[model samples]
Target: MKIAILGDSLVAISTAHSLLDQETDAEVHLFTERPEIGLMNEGPGIFEKWPPCPNHWISDLKSQEPSEGSNSVRRSWFEKAIAIALSERGCIIHLRTRCTDVSSVHVEVKGAGRIGSGRIPFDIVSDMRSVSETSTEWSGGVCITGGEPKLEITGNRSDGTTELWWSGPRKDTGSWLQEMKWIGEDPRESLTSEIKVGIEIARTLVDTIIQKSPGHKIE
Candidate 1:
């Protein structure tokens, strides 16, 4: 089966990661407009006594040589690690690629770095992009305490400083929201739940895609 995972957030990263762990032979393609991940201001547990990123896809986040301010790991570095790992795992990673149009069977993209602009075909096309309507934009930290991604919430934090990705089915066919980052009244408290919720939703979204895939047999 040819599967396409779209988006540029942790959920998208986790989806591609989990899809591969299924051990199926489906050809997986991941596309994002970001020239690279972690370019945004992602917070961290990078300096915590226990550094995270040890589970699945996030585990691919490698610890590079300690830099001048080795206090906390940069989200840019952390995210890039996962992308590299996904590429090594046989996922056709397309950076600087943006999907102009999407349907149930294919995605029209203008891509670079690894893919030229073209319409890519797929047996199943999963839209992981955050298409929800929200005015909130957040810059938060991320950690890899260890577990798969999932989602069970549908709203944002109280402060409006952050917005959590709603993994629920999007009313529109062109988009589905599934990102993981935010801050609330107590940013720390909200952060913890955000990761948990993010993981759950990402897992649910991808699992649904895999089960519905034409060639994959779900037992």
Candidate 2:
């Protein structure tokens, strides 16, 4: 199967990981507006469950530091690990690529460098980009170097600090939710629930693939 996942959000990474875990032969393509992953955010992060980039992707998961509750790989490592893992496994990573349009079976992207532009075809196209800024009641802020963390939302890192936001995507973001193919329910901790969301989407993809199989019957 071929899939085009929009965005480099952990959700997107997890979705790709989960899909490949279930369907090893699947062809996965990830398009991210960022030049790369890990550059988005830095430092310690907390996840209810750290989505493994799949055990085989990384030779030593322990080196990445996984823990439960208020625990995660340093943001940079986690981000890089998943992206690198996917890439090493043959998932085409399109960096600095912006999606210009989306359809049932294809995505049109405007990109930089090697990925000039194209309408890439896929068996499925999913938008896993975070809708925090667009789909929720929110406020943006910045956490300078040595600044006490006060906000729940965080953005990218720079010189000696990190940027944060006060709000996150919610279940109801009005028409904003319509901006993507699948935006699941947002939980108390947005990052935490994303793993399940990705897995669920993977199941949907698998089911769809099964149904699309020749000679398959729905009953």
Candidate 3:
């Protein structure tokens, strides 16, 4: 099966891995405008999580040397590393490519100058772009601004350690409404937990799709 996954978020990456795992012969392509994986202007604290797999992508992330001084530089390094890992895993990644249109069987994309535009036929086209329309209410003082609202919550755990989490929508572009980030001691464990959540969400979505079409092969 030929599958084209849109976006470069963690969910999109996880879905691509899941689809490839199910069918090794399946051709999977990722379309994104950014050269690196994940959001280009994502915050430093926010990290990309990966679903459980035979080759743990996080291991590559953890093994990287702390050569970069700035957090943004480090994040870019990690994102590039992830892109490499995905490529190694049999995913054809099209960097600097944007999906102009997507239908049931084909995805129209435009690349950089000289690369031009092209259409790729696929058995299934999954839109993994994140959309945020859900409104969250917190107990603290909430302030509405012209741009995206920022909400940060900090609580003390039973062990006396402090836990911090924040969520807000992307004000720049894309369908992503809001994104959440949690501070954890271990990046690997935190990422693993997040990936598990992503996988469950993906499963639910697949289940719904399968329910509609009982004969579809998704697993």
Best candidate, TM-score: 2
lDDT of 1 by residue, 1-219 (tens): 677888766556666766676635768888888777665644332332223333445444334433443434344555676767778789888888989999989999997765588888887787878753454434332223222123322222112222223322322322222233542333233323334444565466567766776798866
Reference-based TM-score, model 1: 0.59
TM match of model 2 to true structure: 0.67
Q: Residue 163's C-alpha lDDT in candidate 2?
A: 37
For model 3, what is the C-alpha lDDT against the true structure? 0.53
Ranking by lDDT: 2, 1, 3
Native-to-model Cα distance after best TM-score fit, residue 116 in candidate 2, in Å? 1.8
TM-score for all models, in order of appearance: 0.59, 0.67, 0.56
Best by lDDT: 2
Error of 1 at 216 (Å): 9.0
lDDT of 2 by residue, 1-219 (tens): 788888887767878878888888889999988878864554333354445334564433444455332233445566677678778878888988999999979999899947699888888888877564434444333344345254454433323344343344433322220111222233235555655677788889888888877899988
lDDT of each: 0.55, 0.63, 0.53
lDDT of 3 at 21: 57
Q: Backbone clashes in each candidate structure, one number apiece?
A: 9, 0, 2
Write down the lDDT that model 1 would get.
0.55
Comparing 1 and 2 on TM-score, the stronger one:
2
Which 10-residue window of candidate 2 scores lowest in summed lDDT?
Answer: 173-182
